[model samples]
Target chain A: MSQIFHPSTNTLSKVSIVSVVLLLGGLGYGLLALNRSPYVARTKIPFDQPVPFSHKHHVAGLGIDCRYCHTTVERTASAGMPTTETCMSCHSMIWTNAPMLEPVRQSWATGKSLEWTRVHDLPGFVYFNHSIHVNKGIGCASCHGRVDQMPLVHQENTLYMEWCLDCHRHPEKHIRPRDKVFEMAYQPPANQLELGAKLVKEYKVQKLTDCYTCHR
Target chain B: MKRLPWLLLIGGSMLMMGCRQDMHDQPRFRLNAATDLFGDRRAARPLVQGTVARGMLKTDTALWSGKVGNKNVDQFPFPITREVIERGRDRYNIFCSPCHGLTGHGDGMIVSRGLKKPPSYHTDALREQSVGHIYNVITNGNGSMMSYASRIPMRDRWAITAYVRVLQQSQNVKVSELTAEERRKLEGAQ
Candidate 1:
């Protein structure tokens, strides 16, 4: 009797086995890439807002300090969003008639809050504190990027556990002088590691890699 | 029929991988998050009228109101030190310098941008004004200036007031009061 299968059956079965493994591996990789993509993470993507607030104009041009509007950043867990009154503080005089600031005027007139789109919302479980970071010598530009240059704010870094751990593991790599924490154009000096090492010790920044550090 | 188990396994695994957001977005309100449950749609509720949180009752008329018995006090509630002055300088640069100018010349960037120029700190009227008066202006605002009470804390307002005094002194230093060494340094700049 003829063999149960053609002689080429051996090769076919062998090739199928390898191809199945390759296909599964590719799918796994694709899913991970998709998870980290801009679509999912919203990194570097600007969101539409009720008003076109420009950090570049306010921070770089007008030289307004971050704390001027985000008043509670240095003391509270949330970097407080400026109230409508904060906007009208300047807009009431400067851009009194600019149509671009109509929503601000409306909010001021109606006593309603402007619904600003959040840019750097982390997962709910992550217990991040801005005051601790700002007080511990982390410059605004370190994580927020050149906000002074961004016409519209966007997420400068991927809000990923791995990315956060990268800094939390070795905070010296990003630490700066406390005085320079709000400086938007701050640059790491030539002796960064040297200065950073000293600062890390002086600031007592712990390498908090434990799960509870962020998760709790 | 035999292949049904394999299909079910693959489909079940894909469904499981589709979502794990239960922990990522637990049912809780974050700061400033919008809510539909309230008529105002604000996650954060305004404090009720006359509601004072613990440790927030502002009873010190001198510190909170910058006045005692309806008169703005000339003395600060707390003693000023070098450290306090430095902190004042820091806070002043952030909140006050934008409209008041670094030298208190009333020509800050905001002034150039068309906001009414604030009065120079070196003006005789301002120089003679008590510290608490300035703090009151910051707390309650004056003329076109809006109230900064919500922006600057009580201690920081006093600190800024102290720094404003320093700026006034800096710009109005008497030439004869300069020491020989300081006068030489000033002359060398020219």
Candidate 2:
């Protein structure tokens, strides 16, 4: 082997300096790349809002139907939010003085929409049509965490793409009656495997096993 | 290792495609239901047919009123139960309560907002209406009321009519003669 020469003290220090500089350059590049592009994040973002609302009270306590507020869910792509007027129609007379409800009243008076914290959010690339899914009898609880039992609505589910496609690939696993849409802690029915299998066969639901469908 | 990684990636990629057409070959669940029993031939069989034989015997012809379309043809057979009532209540709350109000009093939130108030269930017109007529209204939808026939099954509508009657009776119970003990209980004498 060719003899590797021993360096002088100054030369050795220079090598160390170069190595440290290179390592730090690589690290700085990584962090800058991370900060610049949003791709490095491991968690989904939680949105903030003006007022806190509870699905638990209406759905669990009073048994108010899910369709009452999210009216267009069964027939339209977007489940329309409760307009300020919808709140004022009831809250105006029912809980006229509740401080939390003041924002709703204010929004109504100003003819402005409430900046409701979106609990169930999807990525911009993912095209989720609430109407089509609901019309096809896919329960709301299939994706949304049990909204009926939640007090201050937050994104209870991680809503990862994999979590969604799991059901899209095998909808039979999540098929249920339309009424159980808001029920939390609900499990796939006892005969779920069998029923899901039947639905899979009957509806001929094609599993979305393509990458481009999501990435695009 | 390269091949393994490539295969997994391909497999995972494949899972992200399609609308769920894979499990078609899986054995389907068989339910012992009447509807399923005749599932294959349901379309082949006619939905509603009236078979009538004009009387060769002359004296049997008699006048009829109210529902007189076909006396010779048998009435439709339906079984009403508590389960159906519960199911109807659930379905009604979801669909009907939006317009008709929770108590069927025409005071629902939608009505309060702008929608028209539907006919009261407490009225004698609704109380004495046949289950079939009520079913027709639900299926065909009356006035501003949209049809729920598609969303609610045939049996549940009958159950809803039954529940409506219960509501009417609750609202219109007349004060009548009571036994001594019953009167005491009514008077809260305990």
Candidate 3:
């Protein structure tokens, strides 16, 4: 028998490739584990909106509901932005001729969305469902902070898996009416901790601590 | 050697899949839905589970109080109230009013634009639902709605529930107020 060997890839290059691959793999795993644990509060989201909508003016003064502009939030994937016409509905008739509000008025007349900058965006790899949280009795302030006070909305909470699981672990204490889903804390029923724990247990919230919850 | 990477990738994915339960069909929260819908027989036993009364299921009760150690709610550092409701209402109108309408009739402009309108709050099923149940819908949202859980507060979510109840009641109230004599008695004028 006669043996002939022909190699396209060099041994030296293959060894170098292996070493590089190992180094990269170690770095990726390290980052993965670091991100696994929750990071609290919004050291992340640089939230800013276009129109600078004021919850104080609308809610405190006019008595609007959180669902009004973010309409589809109760049943859809996005807690949708109000259509330009939605703003015009009232602004056109109510503020009808206000000079300062002309931009909003114009947007409504033209049918363009507000182009609001997302303040509390979790990663694309993350999965978030509003109906689940709303149904689970979670509030808005749990992630967005006290939005009523903000003239221009900012991401108040970190929205990490830890932030979400902490409450997923106990829904009743944090659970309240559907409207108050955005509340900062569980005030009513006095013993929020106790109540939250009760809801979690009652609902049997398990593996909320599991990685696949927020992670895809 | 060429197929080793493929084998490893497939193996790793299988391992990850094996660690988790079936989340795809997990029973989501629904109005007036039984706690046992998720099949936790132990948690479903008590006669009075809705209230804070504790009996056999001590662990679930602890989860209610935020004493579950590793797991807790992300509520404010305080309790929820009407103030929270007011704020939530403001946001809801700005965000939800377009589709849900002011009264939650699900007949917003979008519906008029040919989007499907939702059930009216005046419906008996929705009327019978709890405020907490409605809040869950608002936060996690329903069929077409998105999670305002990120934008609205938990307390304000409850407030919206309160308001929705008001709408429901207004639309379906007894629809028959009593006479002056009964009204006087109700007011304690006697």
Candidate 4:
């Protein structure tokens, strides 16, 4: 009342209001950008497995089929991990004394499994089946990117709900011949949409939009 | 006004943190996790004795085990229809052809990659071996071969055996045994 307040107090209050609004707006945008970034989503971040199994060496260089190790991809809910037996089938003779494969040999000898870290993990609520996808003509490369090129495996797709829905809604765009499911180098033909449509009918693929299709 | 924005920011972050606990701390047993509620201390319960799961009752020994009275049967339990053979071909290509080779030559891609090369099915030893032996190998796994029983169902195992027979026959067909029409086709192709 007695000139205690500065003459510029009103201007200071106005500036404070403008700064607060700008800060909040920037915060929201930053959060969204970070959420969608590959860094946060863990795409292309190679995980350290117990054994440094290289998809590049096995699948690309040696030309081993995906089904050789992932034996249950076409028949089970999960693409089963290879047993120690599967690894030793070759390693027993090929790289018997390689220090890198000592863990594999130990696991085989002790009958204990190597604890390989999983890369593409979905949340508990989400339900995904490798067999259904493979049997319905989804090529390994469609969702996994060029795994044959990666020396160490990494998550290629965001694996977010929105990412799944994109393919689920327009599955024809992703579908390939069933024979090509394991083909790492498969590419969509010029008439992919047409081929996809034909396959959708032939494979009887349900265009599932309900939450239960995946969530349950 | 300055105090109000600071309070709002703190409250929003607190609210977000509160929501995290519900899903992450939900009561559930993870695979092979230990649990005190069970006597075995295993989260996974053992199947009750004599309780067979639905669609898993293996009453027909021949169909399920490819054997009759502890001896491997020479014949398939079911009729070898064309469709069954085709199904066998598909299953064989996926499962058996990896090691046995598409032509049963024991020269599958794996063999070239330096895994042990299995004996060729075209060899007289394997050609004369009973179909049941092939089926037994698939079900129980032979030396250096992993058992495919878990990966391939019993019916598909039979189908694969049938396809292996087809492969063996393809490689060892006699010119005199060929039908007149088949002989003509072979001559023309040659």
Best candidate according to lDDT: 1
DockQ, model 4, C-alpha based: 0.27
Question: Which model scores highest in TM-score?
Answer: 1
Over A3-51, each residue of candidate 4 has an lDDT whose tens digit, in order, gives 8878899899999999999999999999988987889888989999888
Sorting all predicted structures by TM-score, with the top scorer first, yields 1, 4, 2, 3
lDDT of every predicted structure (CA atoms): 0.91, 0.62, 0.60, 0.84
The DockQ value obtained for model 1 is: 0.75
Candidate 1 chain B: minimum summed lDDT over ten consecutive residues — where? Answer: B17-26
Interface RMSD of 3: 14.9
Task: Give residue A42's lDDT in candidate 4 (0 to 100).
Answer: 89
User: Which residue ranges in model 3 land beyond 4 Å of their true spot?
Assistant: A1-48, A170-173, A177-189, A201-207, B1-184, B187-190
Task: Put down candidate 1 lDDT per residue, A1-216, tens digits, no spaces.
Answer: 979999899999999999999999999999999989988889889889988899999999989999999999899888899988888888889879999999999988887778888889888889999999999999888889999998899998887999999999889889999999998888899999899999999999999999999888
Candidate 4 backbone collisions, by pair: none
lDDT at position B73, candidate 3: 35
User: Which ten-residue region of model 1 chain A has the weakest summed lDDT?
Assistant: A110-119
What are the per-residue Cα lDDT tens digits for candidate 2 across B1-190? 7699999999998987754534422233311111233533221243355544464332322111112353321222345467767866766777667656777777776556455567888788777766556666776666646455445555565567666656667677654756676777877964
- Candidate 2's DockQ is 0.06
| TM-score for chain B considered on its own, for each of the candidates | 0.91, 0.54, 0.48, 0.80
Per-residue lDDT tens digits of candidate 4, residues B1-190?
8799999999999888855745533477644455678664657686789999897899888889888888988988999998888999988876667666788898877777676888998889888888788899999888878777766778889988998898889888889999999999999999
Q: Write the per-residue lDDT of candidate 1 for residues B1-190, one digit (tens) a residue.
A: 9999999999999999858887778899988889888877889998889999898887888888989998999998999999989999999999888999998999899999888888888889999999889999999989988999998988999998999999999989888999999999999998
lDDT of 3 by residue, B153-184 (tens): 55566566666766676676341466776667
DockQ of each: 0.75, 0.06, 0.07, 0.27
Candidate 4 stretches with Cα past 4 Å from truth are A1-31, B1-9, B15-51
